[model samples]
Structures are given as C-alpha cells and as structure tokens.
Target: MPSEIAPAGLRERKKEETRRLLLEGAAHLFKERGFEGTTVADIAAYANVSVRTFFRYFESKEALLLPDGVEIFAYVEHALSERPADEAPLDAVCNALLAAAKPFSASTLTALSHPLEDIENVITARLVQAFSDFEERLTVLVQRRLPPDTPDADLKAAVIACAALSAVRAVLRTRRARRASGISDTGPAPLLRAFGILHEIGSPERP
Candidate 1:
C-alpha cells in the first residue's frame, strides 16, 4: 500500500511543482513583455517545459491569470462563516475580502492585474462573468447572516456585497495604477483604507 501511495504522492507533487513553474514563468514574462506580447510558447520556454505541457496545465495564456474559482470561493465562504456573528453584514464581507486576499503576494496580485488591464477581449468578458458569479454568491452568503424578518433582505444583501466588492476593485485599480507609475505597494493597508472610505460614505457628515 505504501509503495503504491508513494508513487502517486510523488506524481502529484511533481504536477504541482510544474504548475507552479508555469504560473511563475507566465507572471515573469507578462511583467516583462506585457500580456498581449507574451505567448504560451514564451511562457513554456520560460518554464523550460514544452508548449504541450503548458496546454496540459492551462487552456490558454489568459488562463494563467484567471485561476479556478472553486478554491477562492470556498476560502471566502469559510472566512465569512468564521466572522463574529454580531458583526455587520458589510463589515463581515469586507473583512472576508481582506482575508481572502491574504494568500496572494504583491507580485501575484500585480500579475493578475496585468491581464485585467491589457486584455479587454476574452479575458475582460470572462472577468465580468466571474465577478457577476462572485457577486451573486456573496449576496446569498450575506443574506444568510441577516435577520429572517429584515426589510428588503435580498436588496440589502446585494447592496452590501456589491459595496464590499467595489472596495476591493478600487484597491486593485489603485495598485495597478501605482505599479505603472513605478511605485510599489504591499500588504492590506490600501485595502483597509478603501473599506474605511466605504464606511465613511455610509456615515453621517461630521464637522
């Protein structure tokens, strides 16, 4: 049993390593050459793998930026579920977005942003569809946390989820702009600030 399992485990590890290499290679090339300038062959050569191997891991060059959604959705769900029961729905969602972002490094986030900025064709359409799915899922999750008798419960959930997601989008756009300006930003400070502005928008005016 151990012998059989060992080979299987080793194969899985190799597959994961190859996947990582492809992702890293794609990122590096995308950064250096821009998304439209970088081809699958380029990425494959960067990773020292055949182009066929690249196709085995990803459908196209665009896919390197657009990862599978299942894992991220699960992470967001778990983070949302773990938020304090007493927290406001929007606050919980914002915190969960922050938590969901914790796993990505600055370079990874920047790489993801490249496709977002450069390719306004297939990738853009796919991103819009993906965000719509996320928005719908977040609304359902937020609604689950609300009081059963809450007024306009569905409307409220959709608003809260959309607002939280907008905050994240705002942060990513800022990061992308800053990167283009040769400035660097890291950590969640910008994201927190975006949420702070969101909260302020909902508050009464102060002197």
Candidate 2:
C-alpha cells in the first residue's frame, strides 16, 4: 500500500508551487503587456492556473512585484534586536537600512534598466505599496526597540521611517533622471547622495 501523505504538507507544497507559477507568469505578462494592462485572468492563463489560484497567492498585481519587502522588514527587525545596547537608535536604524538596501538596491537597479513604461506601472507602483506597508511595521519595530520611558517614540520612528523611504525614492528618482537625460554612467553618486540625506536625518539631534 502507498504511504499516506500529510494533508498540510501537501497543501503547503501546492501553495508554494502556485506562488512560483503566478510570480513567473506575472513577470512575463508585465514585461510583455505592461502592468496596468495585464489582468488577473491573463496572469492566471499565462501561469496555466485558475484565477482563484492567482488570488490565493497575491491580493493584487502590485503585490507580485514587491513581495519580499515585508519579509525583509522582519529580517531587519531581527537584526536590530541583536544590536549593542550602547548603540544609538538612529545608528541601529542606519545599519538596518544599509543592510536592507543592499538586496533591494540591486533589484531596483535591474528593474530600472528595463523600459520605463514597464516599471512605471509595475515595479514603481509595487515599491510604493511596499513602502506603505513597511511604514507601520517599522514604526512598531522602532517603538519596541526604544526604551519604555522614551517620549514620542512612535512619532520619532515615523519620521525616521519616512526619511529612509524618502532616501530610497530619491535614489531611484535620480537614476530615472539620469536615464532620461541620456547619461549612461550616472554611477553611484545618486545613491551616495540619498544615503547622505538619510543619515543626516537619522542622526540623533539632527542638525
């Protein structure tokens, strides 16, 4: 007789396969038809799956493009928890931002190299959505990390989060401007400038 398989294990495996297929299909469709034009049914058809299966993995098309940001935020929170007690809150946040940006920056560069129209509706929109999701998460994470007696921890955290996001958007916008200007080698200057601005804002007692 064949061994009985666990229903939960099978369900999880099926979910993973469905997720992979949906993402792959969505990427292709977004590249081919532009993100705004690609419908859920189109993605489902491209993946050879039902429309319901597509919704099981992603709530909206914008999700497929930036699925990792939430996961990255969890990793960042974990990393922050391991920081030295003597480290300033801003310093800890800066470190986390740098680490988080490494992977995200690389992916954004790859996306930026693609046609502007392809990314405008798909990649950029997804990034904005991800940042919106991250803001609340970051606020909570910062509150937890700060001392219980700290005043206005949530507000300060919100400011820091906004500053960090602003930095990221500025960097990407600079890259877009460079491309628009027909300058091929804008180099790391734009990214460096973004970091500088973020650091200034994130520093304790911002000057």
Best prediction by lDDT: 1
Query: Number of clashing pairs, model 2?
Result: 0
> What does each candidate score in C-alpha RMSD?
3.9, 6.2
Q: Where does model 2 exceed 4 Å of error?
A: 1-28, 31-37, 44-62, 108-129, 182-193, 201-207
> Taking the tens digit of each residue's C-alpha lDDT, what string does model 2 give over 80-160?
777776676666766676665555545444343332345454566656566688777877776676788888888987877
Residue pairs clashing in model 1 are none
Candidate 1 local lDDT, 1-207, one digit each (tens): 899999999999999898989878876776687778889999899888999999998988877777644456668888999999889998899898789778866654443344545444656676777778988999999999999999999999999999988787788788988877998887888889999999999885989
What TM-score goes with each of the models?
A: 0.76, 0.61
- Please report how far candidate 1 places residue 199 from its true position, in Å: 0.6
